[model samples]
Structure formats: C-alpha cells, structure tokens
Target: MKYDTIIIGAGMSGLAAGVRLAYYEKKVCILERHTTIGGLNSFYRLRDRNYDVGLHAVTNYAAPGTRTGPMAKLLKQLRLRWDDFDLSPQVCSSVVFPGHKIEFANNHGEFIEAVCAEFPQQADGFRKLVKHIEEFDELDLSQEAVSGRKVLGEFLSDRLLIDMLFCPLMFYGSAIPNDMDFSQFVIMYKSIFVQGFARPFAGVRQILRTLTRHYKQLGGELKLRQGVQEILTKNGKAVGVRLDDGTEIEADNVLSSAGIVETHRLCGTSLPTPEPAYGELSFNEVIFVLDRQPQDIGHNETIVFYNNTEDFIYAPPEAPIDTRSGIICSPNNFKYVDSQQLEEGFIRITALANPQYWMSIPDEEYYPAKQHWCDQMAAAAVEHIPDFRPHIVDTDIFTPRTIKKYTGHLNGAVYGAPHKILDGTTGVENLFICGTDQGFLGIVGSMLSGITIANNHLLR
Candidate 1:
C-alpha cells in the first residue's frame, strides 16, 4: 500500500515524528517491532511490579506554564499540553569525586555557585566557560565536530574538574568514549545542569501514553509487531520498507530511528567515507525494588554520579561491569505534587559494561552473571550512598544484549553511533535518520529530534 510517510521504530523520535506528521493531516504510520512503544524507555511488569527499562531521569525539565525551553517547545510542536508529561522536578543531585562534591538543583546559578565554592582557584575560568557556553550556538547543524574536553581545557585549568563535568554528561548522553561532541556536550550540559532532571509520577508510561494517545487522535497509524526487514529502494532512493513477514509497504518518504550504520546496512549499502564507528558505550541497568523509600534510609538525593578513582573513565570497561564509576538514581526522590509517591522504592544503577562479554554471553549463564554483578555493583554503590541491600525486596538486571534485543542497535549502544548525522540526511534522496545517531540527546532532545527532522525533511 502506498502512503505519505512510513516511520520505522516507535521510540520517542519515531512517535513524536508520527504525531507531528499526523497533526498536519499527512498519512503517517509508525511501525514498532516491539509489541508496545517507548523503545529504550519502555515499561514492563514482572511479578506484579512495574519497571522502567531505560528511564533514569527525564532531563531538560521545564516547570509547567513555562513558555520556553525544550520541554515547552516539545509540547507546543506536538500540540500537547504542559501537564501531559506530569514532570516532577528533581529535589537535588550531586557529582562526587575523590575529595570534592558539587550539588545542583534546577537553578543554574546555584550550580555555578557550588562549582566556584568547591574550586576557588578555577572560579574565573568556570564563569568564562559558562559565558562561552551561553554565547555558543550549539544548535547549528553545520557546526564541525569539536572535542568537548579540549574546549573545556581552554577555559578550565584543572583536569579533575573537567573529568568530573564530563562524567554525568558522558554517562547520560555521550556516544564516543571518554569525550563528547562539543555540540552534544553543550546540549547535555544545558539540559542537565541548566534545566535539570525530572520524572513523571507514573514513570515512563506517563509520557509514552501521552504521546501515543495524542498521535492516534491526530489519525496516526500505529502498527505493532511489524518488524522492518529492509528498506525498499529504487535507483538509490528509498520508497518504503519490507516487514519481517515480507509484507512491503510503500511511501513517498522513509524515516528511520534504527541508527546510522544499522539504517544504511538495511539499504544494502555502506555510508560514504569516514565510515561511522559502531558505538561501544552500553551499560548494565541493575534495578533494586526496595520495600521502603530511599529517604527512609537517609539517601535523599535525586541522583548521584560517583567515581571511586581520581579520574573518571567513560570508556567501555574491560570488566563485566565497571563499578568504579556509575549513575545511582532514586526515582523516589523527585518533588512530586500532592505528595505523590511510587508504591515501591527503586534504586537504579547503571554502569558501563563490556559489550562483547554481555552480547556473547551464553543464555544459560546470563541470569547467574547478572546476579553476581548485581551484588557486586551494589557493593560499590553503597560507598557513595546509604546501603539499600537490606531494603531490596527484589532485583532486576539487563545488559547490552537486552539493549540489542529491544532496540536493534549494534553493540546495544544506547546513544546509537559515535558520529551523528545532524541534518538527518542520507545518500538516498528520501531516506533520513533521527533519534540517537541524529545527535539530540535525552528524552526532551530525542522527541525534538523527531520534530526537527520531520519539519525539515518530510513534511515540506
């Protein structure tokens, strides 16, 4: 069947694009391989308990009634309301290194003050860096690839501070090892430190359901269990897609959230030179379901980014899980309205993992390995936060293999490719890429990625 656009994958980028396109009365269909939507940020139930797959914190949080920022603009573009996301701002979060700790909330000024208070010698440089960041146009699609670390070095003299700053940004968004694309760095910095983190009281389902319902009301077609096998092309132009069942659907244009290298390979072609490297940055998400809130144990921070060693290492670890550095998120700590609270407490820890080991692990050994690492990772995490093992009633863990199974990313790279196609262009005339490899980051950025690509390329 011929149509206007067939968007592959039902993740944030794909769904948001579907909603935007459908809102304009374009014939649009979203094909999701998974039975449900949300992609990496999906939700599931096990033993009668709900769990979020990829959500740690929804960064770039803007309070309700706010007229600007990514959050507000996302709502505006999709024709959604401010309360649709039900975002509760983070109470506070911290970055803990060897001898220094910097705490920040939604206030950019407070974060700046904390940084200056901790690093008295580098205060001038830090302020200058902030000023430069404010002046820099990180949204320019034509901006050349520059090193975030090198740029930080130009302003800040301390390597430790640089690494600390890179820790949270890299863990949450960086695709490249130990460094980030400068634009990406700015985008993430602004989203996290500037705008800060927040979450829906109902978890990822809140945002996913809102997007899904909105898209359907706009007459968007959502087809689940329809896995795309290939992109049907003619004379180097993408016409549509072939489903796994060999059902071919035609469209005037094709948009993909399948990642850069993976998307090109589906076309039976290679990306023209400077061949994009497959991302190796994947992590093991170990979630502990506790009997009580983390605050009961005196661990009240919204999130903690900790590094045991002097220098922060952001690369794929040689070990099964790198507990030396990781992210600890207590979903129970957000400042929800009406004193809303989750039924159960959750301590979700994400640590860099060796993709090769996890992806190649024997099916028989998977659960055992997960259990062993879960125990070990929690041990490392207790050093920076209150020990919650006594309170954990149940535990769940997923690795890079799970990421690949769910998202189809090579090496289960959470952020897709090391290189980004900022403009979403491909060699094929009507084929484009969005989501992770397109370079906008986090939930807010990812949703905006879909809207930007659709507005720029498809809906014209």
Candidate 2:
C-alpha cells in the first residue's frame, strides 16, 4: 500500500515528524539506515558501561506543567507529558575565560546579575540586549539572515562580554564559523540562558525510546537498518524512495532529516537552487569514566565552556583537536530529583576538531591519536576545573569520522548546513528537509523542526 508519508532518518526530527503525521491518521513509515534509532544521539555499551553519542544536555528546559516555551510546546504538540522526557534541571554551568568568568543556572535573572556583576560597565547595555532578544521573533520562518555579532555590537560595547555570551550558544548550535544568524542567536540565548539546561537520568536513550514508542503507538511504521539509497522522483515530485537493497516503496510525500547537502544528492532531481555548502566545524568527544563522582574530586559544575584565551576562536582547527578551548561536563552534577545518580562517574570533554585531519588519519594510528589528544583535551580542561585526571579509569573517544560514519552528515557537520531551510521546502514538490538543516537545534529544537515541517507542509 502506498504510504501517506515516508520519512528518512530515524533521528529526533524524523521520529517526531512520523509521530505527528501518524497521529493525524496518516500512513507513515520511518526508515533508518542504522541498526538502531537516534541517528546523532544514539547510545551504546562499552565494557559494560553505557555512553551517549551526542547529548550534552537537553536545552530549553521547563518544569513539569509549564504551558509556555519550547519544552511545553513540544509536549503539547506531541501529546506527551513532562514525565515523558524525565528532565532534571542542571545544577549550574559556567563560561570561563582567562581573567573572566560568569556562572548561570536555570534562572535568567541569575545570569543577568552575574553578567552585570562581572562587567559592571556593560550592565546597562547588556540589559538593553536582553530586551532586544525578548522582543525578537526568532521563530519567524521568513526572516532574512542577520549577523548576530553585528547585532550584538549595536547593543553592547564590550567585546569580551559579547564573545562570552556567544560561546555556549555557538558551541551548542551554531553551524556557521565564528558567527550565527541573528534569529539563531536569539533562539539559543532564550533556550540556554532563559530556559536553561536539563537531562534525563537515562541520557539520550530515554528520549529516543520515548519518541519511538509514541510513534509506534500512533501506527507509525519504523524500519531499522533499512537504508534509503535514493529518492524516487517523477516530474519534480517526490514519488517515494528506493532502499539500499533496491526495494522500492511509493509515498505521497517525503521528509528528510538527512541534512540539506546529503538530501540533495539523494534526490537526484532538478532543483531551483544549487546544493548548499555544508558546514566545516566538527568536534572530538572525549569521555572519561572516573573512579568517583565529580563532586568528590571538587568539580561540581554541570558543564563548563572554557576558552584559554580571550579571542574564543570558533573554527576548524589546524591541529588534530583544538586544545586551547573545550567543554567539560559531568552528568552527575545535574540536580536530579530524589538525589538519584548514575552507576558510574563520567567526565566528558568536547573540543573543536579538524575534520579533514581526523577523517584522513591512518587507521593504524587512529586509536593512538585519540589517546594522545584525549590527554591534551583533559590537560586544557583541568585548568578550568579541578584536576580529575587521577580519577579516570576508562576513556572513550569519537571524532568527526565516527560522526560521518553514523549520521551520513557531510564532513560530519554536527549542526548540518550553515544556511538553514527554515520553511522545510526543497525544490522537489513534496520533498522537504528537517533536523539540523531545518534551523532548529538541540533535542527540543530538532523535534520541533520535524513537527513544524509536518504541520506546515505535510499535514496541510
């Protein structure tokens, strides 16, 4: 039977979109190339320990019954409850630069107070910037691109404070190098500083499982390990898809979370615009299992975005990994309800990586390279937080190569194309894009991208 929609990539957006369509009583099938779901945020086991692929924290946090913000909107649209996500708000996180540091929690007031206290001279300007963000409609799809850096300059005169504010937001969501669209800046600002960070006790696995289960219950067909090799198009319309094994299925519409450049290649259809340039930035994720909780080692921050110098260079590094700056996170540091905790102590550090260098490294030297950089990464991190190196027992490293292999992202661009297709429209009549390239970010934003695309384009 012909399906009402065939969604590609069982990542957050694809699964969410499938659920949205199926809930409307449409016939939907979600196909994944990987053996499991959660393309970029899946989980795995190593030496009897669990590891999450891309989750640092679920941004845009909200309480159990809030009726506003992205968190509440997501649950309301998906017909889910807050307990479904099981998010615990972060304890506190900080952005540390040499001779300067500011801390913030879920409370936006604390962040404002910290900024004002830290940069007394820029307090008034900073408040004005906050007002600008509050008034901006970041979710407007038809908005033209505007440089965040330039817009920030119009509000504040302090370069350090501007870079500091941009640090965490860019690290978590920016696809562009050393810059972002103004709308993206507002969205990231509100999500991280205004709404804040949180995580489920079970990491990414819990969220993925929740989405998959809901989709299935709504009569959405999910086929894992069923990779789509190509888009079957007819007269500028998406007819269906051809599986990697050469099986063909027909559908009335197709939605892809596989990213813009990748999807363009798959479509093989004549389009109105040239294929967009994919992003260059990627990361080296270093996970260290410690012998004790991070708090025991005197490190209590949930996540620390540290830059060794004041410049905060945001680009692909010339070296294997950029040790000058990185993020250090301890999952055990979140304010979990009932004082519950994970079974193991974990410290994660993420550094900007040279994607070309990591992807082209000799296989024989890859493992050794990971170890060598892991040491450097930790060395840089210890300067910001207490040295927990002595407590480390096991380490896991994943680079751009691993990302490309799993998600099929061009250059393993974690945030997909630098330019976002906000309207989810491709040149093909019924084929659209979602996920990273669709412009929303993180777990909440990615899921919201799918839902928005489905509601605006598919359902209507």
Per-model TM-score on C-alpha atoms: 0.98, 0.99
Cα lDDT for residue 50, candidate 1: 92
lDDT of 1 by residue, 73-126 (tens): 899999988788989999999999999999999999999999999999999999
Question: Lowest-scoring 10 consecutive residues by lDDT in candidate 2?
Answer: 267-276
Name the regions of candidate 2 deviating beyond 4 angstroms.
none
Over all chains combined, what TM-score does candidate 1 have? 0.98
Residues 334-439, candidate 2: write the lDDT tens digits.
9898999888799999999999998899999999999999989999988888899998899999999999999999888899889999999998889999999999
Local distance difference test, each candidate? 0.91, 0.93
**Backbone clash count, each prediction separately:** 0, 0
* Candidate 2 positional error at 328, Å: 0.6
**What root-mean-square deviation over C-alphas does model 1 reach?**
1.1
